[model samples]
Target: MLDANIKQQLKTYLQMLRHPIELVASLDNSAKGRDMEALVLEIAECSDKVTVKLDGDHAVRPSFAVAKAGEAGRVRFAGLPMGHEFTSLLLALLHVGGHPPKVAPEVIEQIKGLKAPAQGGHFETVISLSCHNCPDVVQAFNTIAALNPAFSHVMIDGGMFQSLVEERKVMAVPAVFDQAGELFGSGRMLLEEIVARLDTNAAEKDAEKLNAKGEFDVLIVGGGPAGAAAAVYAARKGVKTGVLTERFGGQVLDTLSIENFISVKETEGPKLVAHLEEHVKTYDVDIMNLQKANALARTDDGKLAVTLENGAKLTSKTVILSTGARWREMNVPGEAEYRNKGVAYCPHCDGPLYKGKRVAVIGGGNSGVEAAIDLAGIVSHVTLFEFDSKLRADAVLQNKLNSLPNVKVILNALTTEVTGDGTKVNGLVYRDRTTDETHTVELEGIFVQIGLLPNTDWLKGTVALSPRGEVEVDAHGKTSLDGVFAAGDCTTAPYKQIIIAMGEGSKAALAAFDHLIRH
Candidate 1:
């Protein structure tokens, strides 16, 4: 055995090596024992704030692949931090010692100049990209990992870690695991809360555990137009409502504008959603934003169990689904580049903005032909391109489109390229299948009138789905499952109109009320 004096010296040296004041080249396992010992002893003799740099003699790249807790000195018995992720390794060393990484000046300023040491606690950040829509949220967690090593962070990419995601009941991105091991915060978290959770100990854990127990009368699982309407309706009825949403505005936020709703002639989609939010908030509903619904299980007691992104759960007497649909996009070259710039999907939304402009319509179906004829009256010209040999629209609409003098019907043509001048669209390139020729149509906008597909894949087995994948519901918005009902674009409704979704939401709420009273 080594002398007691030698062991003390070695331990002190290891502590110094891990200090925030020092920068290490590499704490490689390949280093000779004697060489390490000598380095340690030499550093012990130095001043209180000794800076012992690692000897650059080992591979640092493939060493710190993943970071974890170190028992006394070594972590995971592997300690091979890999990649230029070596940067993460450095931050890990800093965590067991120095303060959390400093936030940017702007972020620091935004937090009201609040810079307190993180509470002495633990947080497990869980993320699952089942829909692959929340990458920004995952980046937020990675930034948290970059902050302090004392914070144990693991990314559960559901695509890669399906079983773990199922076991944890994670259905969305950015689920926060609290110190109590009970899931706490779900979805994107404010950085201040993250800082507060760091280094927080057991006493606080007990309190948080007690604070998370409560149930709602009605739980709304979406924050779109229909969902928002339902929330307002339920809360006003004094049913004690709760709203869980992946995004606060749901699919309505993606809309550019809305002219159909019974509003002030025209309104932007986001503005309309914001107004709806105000109405919903006027009631007493519990609002949980940026949260994705994870699971729906019926408790043995017959209460509806709602699992969320972070594994936290709630009990509800009735559940309403208002998560809406996304507009279909033609992901062709330049199409995405000019979307919202020159490529618009909803004619009723961005039509007036393009008055007297030349526009190209890409589908030959009913919606496409109608949009083309509509634009021909407003825009300088309209070019309708269809992949089929003939238009699939109704006879009346087809005759109307053909009768429009300014509308040019390009039969058997497919979009190849959307050439643009960065800010706006210049022209479109088309390929004719019959002639085996390609040409470009110089225009200001390309309106995508392709049919829309509802975003109901997440509900495939959660609730009943139609053959086309939309949620199946009755006129009263009752679903196949008890205590569960659906509305809006995600359901198998005939017409996908704003008024229709709102009307359905009202019906769903009444159904929920009746179900709750009966039970």
Candidate 2:
């Protein structure tokens, strides 16, 4: 049943509905099947422009297709659309009704380039109905399919296809696979990643021509908040600025909520990223999304040269490093396989997706405790597992976690494996130290918040790195290298907050601008 508030919202959003649309529900006539039909009918009642039709197709049971009247829809949801996926359903309806896409121009171009005389490929994204991150990945793939007829896609609900989940060893949501049955990736993937997966050679060839010989006054490596900020500042100074990022938003996109951004009372990671991307677009910064900096070197002319993974070389007078940090995995069995499906590192990104589902937090430190506290409000229950005998979090954080009625803390419990059904997380196995007994807890998700790992593997011998691998920088964001600066979580900044990263990025840009003027 639809909530009163949500019903009103849908009415307002669907007022622009053009051309009658049909929601074809394929059912098995089971209890769940009847409920699915009712849900579709309820949605149809929201507006006269939409209608529900039933088909007793057991193969596509619990699935629904949204298409214009008298047409077979290309967009199909092979499972229930609930939780965060509800918004995705709403957005799809809007898109089908002449609402223009919000995909980046470069991404659209890539999709167009993939077009061929014959069908090129197919991408299937496996998702859970509650997964908030699943919608973005689904929408991204849908956008590609809509743009180019050469490709096609379907959003498969992991819960509905248990056999396929088991075959793929799916442990997370938003897992993408190709027509060849090869797993492309899991988690919240960028559009560029999908494009690259579609045509690796073409992606490389395209990167080769992306200003391989052009010189810039300032080139920022990494696409997090810091790098984005630095690029904006340098570009505003009228310098030839460029940004190389594997993905824009960095770890910030993994973050779920933000209340400490200073001026703003509250915001989410994706919203902040949208603002950041919009801000970056306001400038002439040459943003090379999905580009990775492979190696760094000094040219004969005393300029900095950054070699990309695609073999393209970008030479610049100054370079700013804003490569951010990543989550440290538990490295246990099923951890990697289940990533994003049921095992998540970013609680903020995936927590709400697990609403009313039991989840486990591996670790009893500050991050683990904080995650447990956050999940308590959104999930049915939270279980904290610590390898050590006692929690390492501060007294205040521990007190806060203790206040949560649905949270359980298990100390000296070593996680042995992340066990799950073929489709989603179902339980966790751990070993109790004192009793030497193994225990299994039934849960739907696991959030690993043990530690943060800096993205500086490529900079091993190129720069002065701290023992922890963070780039060492000074007050002015200067590194050991004369013409190189670093900022954000990748640098040895005292803090790793978004606002701190942005400030450091501004400092690095100002320093780079100063170097150009004084040199």
Best by TM-score: 2
For model 2, give the 10-residue run with minimal summed lDDT: 114-123
Candidate 1 ranges beyond 4 A from true positions = 1-213, 254-257, 262-266, 331-360, 364-382, 387-407, 412-447
lDDT for residue 499 in candidate 1, whole number 0-100: 75
Candidate 1 on 216-273: residue-level lDDT in tens?
8889888887788888888878888998776777656545457788757887655777
RMSD score of candidate 2 (Å): 4.2
Model 2, residue 351: distance off in Å is: 6.6
What RMSD, rounded to one decimal, does every model reach? 17.9, 4.2
Clashes of each: 14, 8
Task: Give me the overall lDDT of model 1.
Answer: 0.63
Lowest-lDDT window of 10 residues in candidate 1?
73-82
Q: Candidate 1 at 131: error in angstroms? A: 27
Top of the candidates by lDDT: 2
| Runs of candidate 2 exceeding 4 Å displacement | 1-21, 28-52, 56-58, 68-70, 113-120, 159-168, 180-182, 330-344, 347-360, 373-383, 387-390, 394-396, 403-446
Q: Model 2 lDDT vs. the true structure?
A: 0.83
User: How far does residue 331 in candidate 1 sit from its true spot (Å)?
Assistant: 6.6
